[model samples]
Target: MEEESQIVFILFAGAFLAALMATFVVAMVILHRQRQVQNKQKMEQLQLEHERTLLNIENEIQQETMSHIGRELHDNIGQLLSLSKLYLGSSKPEKQAEGRELITKVISEVRGLSKTLNLDWVESISIREFAKQQLDRIQATGFCQTELDQEGDPWELEKNQKLVFIRVIQECLNNAIKHASPNHVSIQIIKNESGRKIIIKDDGKGFDTTIPSKGSGMTNLKKRMETIGGEFLIHSSLGNGTEIKLLLPN
Candidate 1:
């Protein structure tokens, strides 16, 4: 009878151990699946955030372009049209010829401006070309001198990445124009085996970096750079100039 009892006890113990092992395996599988789901959710969240940022950038660019177009229509195209009208009204052949020439020039300018109306141009334009365009605008302002220095070949970036880069550059230039009171602004783009770098510097009244900013512009710029897996850095001092550096990994 005792031997039978001992056998029964052993059987019970074995069953318990087996059940425990099974439970452990099940638990591990559940935990692994939960982790996978969490990782997937995280990835989706990041992707959504990236898309949102891109949309915001597109909207901002569109608004800026529209404002620019308004200025051109009022200040430039309007003047040309008025002049063309006066010339065309003249009885003299020379005046009429001048008016026709002006009209041709106006047509070309309108065509060029119309191209920027589509956001698709943003994706098609190269970063260097965009930089040159921005500098040209600044030079047109007559408030600041601009220069672009490049070394090595430019990197072929994804469309989204290009947009972020262009916006960041725009912000830097805008800041210089708005607050920095810089007489001269310069940009340097370098790409090689080490990495890619863009430096925007201005001879403006620099502020103390240690102090906090009242505006979100700087924070926004940093976030934009982070979205692209790039880095944004600023260097400045009082009475000195300010310099912004953007770095990208290979």
Candidate 2:
């Protein structure tokens, strides 16, 4: 009986030690996993901050260029056109007609360029307005019918997001026009519970993209969206249309 009891006690002690070691290993795994998650989050935040800094510098350079061009259009080229207009108005009928035509052409070009002169204009406008401009450009091409529709109330976005969003939309539009050759392109901005959704759909001659055939441009688009806390998705098949979606968290 004494020997049997000693044996039982030995087994019990061994079992308890095994159980303790198992618990410690589990705890260590959980702690390690938590640290990894925290590290990933910190890295993502740092990357976003870096992107914002680069984008700000880019915008500053673009703004400076716009200012210089604006002044040139308003002061130099604008003055030349005004003087020609006056000179033509005072000349004989034949010369006056020619000068009037020349002046009219200059006026039209200047008017068109003036719209592009506002340095801070792109960052100041709402997304809908920016989308309209892109659609209008597509419309001007006469290659496709462009339309934009909104769902839910408009959402406010920061300067960096706005810049990235506009560029991403432009990229999608360019891809649609260049590759898809679509007859119609539509954009929709819907505000949902998860976030804001921007859908770019085209009734173009889509191709097979099932094998992850997107080039660097598309990859860049994905990275940019991820940086802005948004997701990019693309769906397309042979002989069908292409659809691209951008989702931003609320």
**Clash number for candidate 2:** 0
Clashing pairs in 1: none
**Residue lDDT tens for model 2, 86-177:** 76877488777877777887778777667666546766679999899889968986988999999999978887777778778877898898
Q: What is the lDDT of every predicted structure here?
A: 0.92, 0.82
Indicate the worst ten consecutive residues by lDDT in candidate 1.
Answer: 118-127
- TM-score, predicted candidate 1 vs. hidden true structure: 0.94
Best by lDDT: 1
Clashing pairs in 2: none
TM-score of each: 0.94, 0.65
lDDT of 1 by residue, 157-221 (tens): 98888889988998999989998898899999999997889999999999999999999999999
* Residue-level error in angstroms, candidate 2, position 68: 14
Candidate 2 residue 247 Cα shift, in angstroms, is: 0.3
